[model samples]
Target: MEDSTHTGALLVVGAGPGVGMAVARRFGGVPVGLIARDEVRLRAMTETLRLEGRTVASAAADASDPTALRAAIGRIIAELGGIDTACFSPLPPVATIKRAAATDAEDLLTALALVVGGAATTVRAVLPGMLARGSGRLLFTTGSGALHPSPERASPAVYTAAQTAYIDVLRRDLSGRGVAVAHVAVVGPVGADGHRPEDVADALHDLADEGGSTVLHLTEGAR
Candidate 1:
């Protein structure tokens, strides 16, 4: 059931399919703002939610571009009034994936720009209002490499590790401030190994509703 006391809108960065859309759907009871690079996909997702009787808005911006991303977030905040929950779950391009030994500096930089840079930009954009309100939820979806680094997936691992560290610091710094920060690390690929997107969304929803400093290592059949 949706909490009657919480009325602020949700802003979803990297609002693509799978986990992104699932998170939006899970929070459908409240007004939602979607952000992604694809304008067409954003329009389609917006319409889908609207058709479901949901209050939703969308913007197209590449997460890796801080200027564009901040602008997109600003537009959504204007449309939705205020954001109480923000989720960051961008999937890096397949071309960026490379093993540690094989990865060049350029490859690592590109991944970092999308993963760490995007998360930081989104947090800076939303954090001030949340701090003033003394309540909000900052949720992040990352891969198992974040917690247990894999040399086979070096680019993603490095960025996610940094992101996880950022979340940990925020958890400590924001403790008792009424805002909650949570990280959900998927131990396996979604849609395979029984790790469904809906389940991930469910976990994120729980974190948003029950404010706390939590790091949930999500695996198949484990909530």
Candidate 2:
């Protein structure tokens, strides 16, 4: 996705260790927004980036909460000027199991609801601003798990389905707009023993190469 245009800022929803911080640091010196629940952790990250001469900002909100997310993104736009890129890494707790038969109803529903519903909330909140500008990057971090469900794992089929559907919605819904929706199709564990966040950030930033329509992938594992 190549573009002659530029964005005012980048907003990251799940500001965690791997991809989240990596993306922030990649654009650290620019006006950026960090949205996550752990204020203490966020403050530490902001402080670190500031010490490194990055003009970073922060907003606290659980992406799973509709009202809180709206307020948080609203504040980010106000502080960061404008969000040209919205990256969602909403790492709400997930129920991973060793066997499919062991999955509980509560765990399955919660996971499915959060991933599907939360993705919807984030997309709805960000796309309007993105479309108005006609040039923006809306990114979501996804893993190999979304592509495939292992029978050995006690994974809820619904969770995987919802995630795939969520990505498809972005791909299909935002085709004509100048906004570019991309997914960091993760292949392995997010942090250690897999592709690093820095690597993923590099991959995502490559979207700058072609800035039209929507982009997504199931990278290494088709799961």
Candidate 3:
């Protein structure tokens, strides 16, 4: 395992496309750990990184599952020492739009569980060593939901609430703890020309490297 802070192992929890890929590429040349539920996407990203001659690894797991997530993190730590920065962007591709009354209770609960629970899982898995080592970066992605939560889209509204709650927790409790916790809220659709997942990823790692102990509130800085 390589020391992430020292050697630059950026663990991208949701390395699908858009912002996730953008972040991964921005911090080029460092060993990167890409985590995602989709095998194809993970493989594609991993291959791209490897082709570019950068150290890369991939893991398939549901971020909401703490045990599974931790296991994956362990593998990453084993390969890259410890994670210098982690970007948590678990946005589903399809629009999860559901009318308030028609919303599925189970689905909504699961979404909330994954979004918030995964944030906690990812942080907890790495926080211990990061704290002890006295350096790390923890960042999460929030889109339109964080800025303007809609009650009409009940499922998204719920997810947004949880995402915001997690960001607030990071800002309040974890910001100044040697490991800088930052929030990048892409208020619009995040993509290549937009404020995509990769965009958030880049911000996360860059801030982590800066290590200013500042709580970044990037509300759509660049798309």
Candidate 4:
């Protein structure tokens, strides 16, 4: 199916290479707003999309900081007119990864702040506009560790599972409200094996355009 075109703005949080960039490109037909912690990288990505003849804007903020993230989202919304679709895929820091035996409370808390907390903050920031307009799409991407526990990746597993549940509840509450929510679980390493970022982007695009299911699992060999 051809990717549906969006007339309103699309916001990509945790915007960077791989999945984030692929999403931005996939939805480049609309005014694209990007949010990431690295100002330099965000500017570069914005410029890259602009060079492609896309209407692009960017803001720098760490998703873990709610104040910063909200401000960034507001700036993007002001610049792009309003966010009609928002995609969030913030990866937890490497230090947060630890085996179950080696994991501590602090590690789990940090992961929660970055993964679940960040997603919630992003949702809160964009939801008002979506609700006011009576239409919007909230898309999220996480690792399959969300569904299958990984002893070696204890922190991620805990927070991603929480995030998955959060998205599920959001979908349940938002049903018949005109706003769509979907989560995509990536089963393997992106850009390796047969799993590509573009394929994931396509799945996300589908979810945003066609809101049938609340969750989708993107494996290495499947779309």
**All models: lDDT?**
0.82, 0.69, 0.71, 0.82
TM-scores for the candidates: 0.91, 0.84, 0.83, 0.92
Stretches of candidate 3 off by over 4 Å are 1-6, 93-96, 196-223
RMSD per candidate (Å) reads: 2.1, 4.0, 3.9, 2.3
TM-score for candidate 1, residues paired by index: 0.91
In model 4, what lDDT does residue 189 have? 68
- Using lDDT, rank the candidates from best to worst: 1, 4, 3, 2
- Give per-residue lDDT, candidate 1, residue 12: 92
User: What C-alpha lDDT, on a 0 to 100 scale, does residue 52 get in candidate 4?
Assistant: 83
Which candidate do you rate higher for TM-score, 1 or 3?
Answer: 1
* Cα-based RMSD of candidate 1: 2.1
Candidate 1 lDDT tens digits, 19-115: 8889887776799999998899889989988898889989999999999999999999999888899999987656867788998989888878888
Off by over 4 Å in 1: 1-5, 209-219
Q: Which 10 residues in a row give candidate 4 its minimum summed lDDT?
A: 212-221
Q: Which scores better on TM-score, 3 or 4?
A: 4
lDDT of 3 by residue, 1-223 (tens): 1234355578888667667777777766678898988898888888987887778878888887889898988888898877777778787423456777877767777777678888889988888888887787777776555456666767776787777776676767765567777765555555544554554555565555543222223354443
